[model samples]
Target: MVTKESWSMSIWPMAPWKITFLIYQREKLLWIGIQMKVAAGAAKGLEYLHETADPPVIYRDFKASNILLDAEFNPKLSDFGLAKLVQLGIKTHVSTRVMGTYGYCAPEYALTGQLTSKSDVYSFGVVFLEIITGRRVIDNSRPTEEQNLVTWASPLLKDRKKFDLLADPLLEGNYPQKGLHQALAVAAMCLQEEAATRPLMSDVVTALEYLATNKDAGQGGILEEPEEGEEDHIEADS
Candidate 1:
């Protein structure tokens, strides 16, 4: 439990679930602006580890479930068992056995066992996509065509005409069109197939900060507070 003068945070303990579960709750919806705020906070946490740390750290297991939220929806990245420190000037990537959630791994890292900041970028893209579409990275219950979110959304992202289809339906068309376009563009850049093409976490932080601060990005809606005695934990899966 974390506390401040104004509010306290109780970490919710659940497995294989994510921020989306809370954001898309049936009773109350977390507005897009708030979601952007959480995203920016999480990105800043990652930026700190990747750029500010003495030895740049690779958050190899970044995902939504690993992001903890306080009473005000501030995000904190949790779970460092899979984190790796890079000798920035010496090595380009860490050679380790493939690990992390299946759907969130970067394609190159998954194939080569080469872990880097870009791998974390890929994972962030998946989580960001979840925030935008309110869908899981992989959902067996969904139709085969729509089961893999990145794959399903990839084509739609290319066509501006189909962009509206990407927003979380629970949002009920409450989000701003321009904001949705910008958000999807960020996700697409991070999800780039080539690790070298992905934007740095710093760039992501800058973009999300703008989106988060602009209340016009999404219509305000009710925000959900974490229930007492519930905390979320993210455990890496091989």
Candidate 2:
């Protein structure tokens, strides 16, 4: 038998997707700094679930629609229907029926029905990419070549020279190049085809916090090149 609990959370005026849709209607992207803050808050929440909870929880469904935004755009995670508590002990992963929104589920979990904290990390990465590119995870309206955000952007993400192409056109070339590089690096790590290679939510939080702080400080520079290993992997995969 399963039990459920209900608790109150202050109302959030919108979900990230709703906000994105609104901005899209205006042909604009959310300010990069605000995007960073939202990403940080969402990462912190996932970090708490995966690390601070008594029995670490795996948020099996993590996506933009599940992230609520207050009037000020602070992000709060919602919908725990697919959440699962990891059993205490040495088990590193929970074997379960594969369930989650497509285009967001980690490749490993989607293929093998294995669940872990990294599964959530992969979903977070997809949302992060959406925030950066101002595109949906899967948009069939786009040209067939660009319909799947990850499949289309994965190659672009590897080359610093092509990083500019990955930014949302709505940003109007206003975002900091250095910050874009850093953010893409973090996203690439989280979206690794090998789930084991994804960073922990805690590390993701720290990286995003730094980006948010630096963005507020008005930092700007040429984007850094990806590491040799990353470049090689991307090329090989492509």
Candidate 3:
């Protein structure tokens, strides 16, 4: 029986393989719907924060660690202590002291106290890298030059064929490959060096929704469809 305790491995971040294993339990048709909805919900929440809120708050520090998933695996953006509101006519929010997690901090914000909505986009980009690569923002264990997940994975993102690199090793090819790549593309754009280059969160949501709908329709997608027995395979739900 799937009890609250038993659902931890399936829902929590511990051992990404649990999620992969869940993906392996159901047919492509079943799990693909669930995955798209979960991811799209996350995209929509981000969009609401950027556009629906009164002043449009900036999620200064956005990372997977901050993203919490429920039993259904729906993604939710959390931790707003670092969140900032962008006031109209205010060119920038300046701080005498800069604050944020090291790896997720935007290069410009880290160097200067300037804060903008774009800074959050950069962090979101890093989160995307994490979700795709199944690697942390910073991994010191890797070789000298490959410590930063973005630095190591950006090139592979550029190469469409090499998208497989983004899959978590623990998954063993369980995720929808194309969907992962498409999500990576969204992340890559968010990580772009120039703040202006990054798409607005609203746009990001639309893109994700469109991608999800298209994937649902089987009309070719940025993400891929699930293989056989992907979802029902979750460790018998404990």
Candidate 4:
């Protein structure tokens, strides 16, 4: 859990992630550059929690809804209710009851009740994929094959020719194709089912920082409305 001191600090300067969704709803656009910025900033935040913190931390809840942005759109991670401290050199994971938002949870953690920094990495990958695709982590309204964003995107992630298909259709070809490939590559690394295979958050931060600096990463994406179908998939903590 987040310490009392950490809890006492203010987090009021920025817009919440949900507000970002509202903005997209009104303007029909969320820039690819902006997405990269958010991803990089959030990655740095997680890097600190995982590598630079005194004891290291597992940001057990690292989903889009938990991120906030300042007026300049710099991202801040919030809600540490699910955060866990790690004793580096002592153990590899924190054994505990499984918890976290379903669609964003790492498969290993969700199945084994073992939490690690890499679990946060997986969650970050899901959010990154959401940024690139403009799709929710899970949306039941989509066709069955497409409901789980990760599973649906897995095959396309491997084929260079189908990379474009993984991009948000709402981007409408505005983003730099090369940058999209790099961003997706980072996401693919983090989404590796084997926790040990995921890159450390510091490495993820480095890659994302470089991606964010590319001037041609391009402009905007519209948030498409989900088509009519069964109830939307839940993202409730479990």
**All candidates' TM-scores?**
0.81, 0.81, 0.71, 0.83
lDDT of each: 0.75, 0.76, 0.65, 0.75
Q: Given candidate 2, what's the lDDT at residue 192?
A: 93
lDDT over C-alpha atoms for residue 108 of model 3: 76
Give candidates' CA RMSD values in order: 10.6, 7.1, 10.2, 9.2
Residue 238, candidate 4: Cα error in Å is 40
Total backbone collisions for each predicted model: 7, 0, 17, 0
Model 3 TM-score is 0.71
Clashing pairs in 2: none
lDDT by residue (tens digit), candidate 3, 87-146:
876747887889889888887788887878778778867765665555777879889777
Displacement of residue 132 (Cα, Å) in model 4 is: 0.3
Off by over 4 Å in 2: 1-32, 94-96, 215-238
- Candidate 4 per-residue lDDT over residues 1-238, each given as its tens digit: 3248455454365574452472234334444346777788889999999888888889888988888877777787888998888876854675668889988999988988878888999999999898888788888999999999899999988777788798776666545666677788899999999999999998998888776664433322112222234113311111
For model 3, the superposed segments whose C-alpha errors exceed 4 Å read 1-38, 174-177, 216-238
Q: Report the C-alpha lDDT of model 2 over 10-52, residue by residue, as the tens digit.
A: 4545554444553345443344446777788989999999999
Question: Which portions of model 1 show Cα errors greater than 4 Å?
Answer: 1-20, 24-27, 30-33, 94-96, 219-238
Q: Supply candidate 3's per-residue lDDT for 213.
A: 71
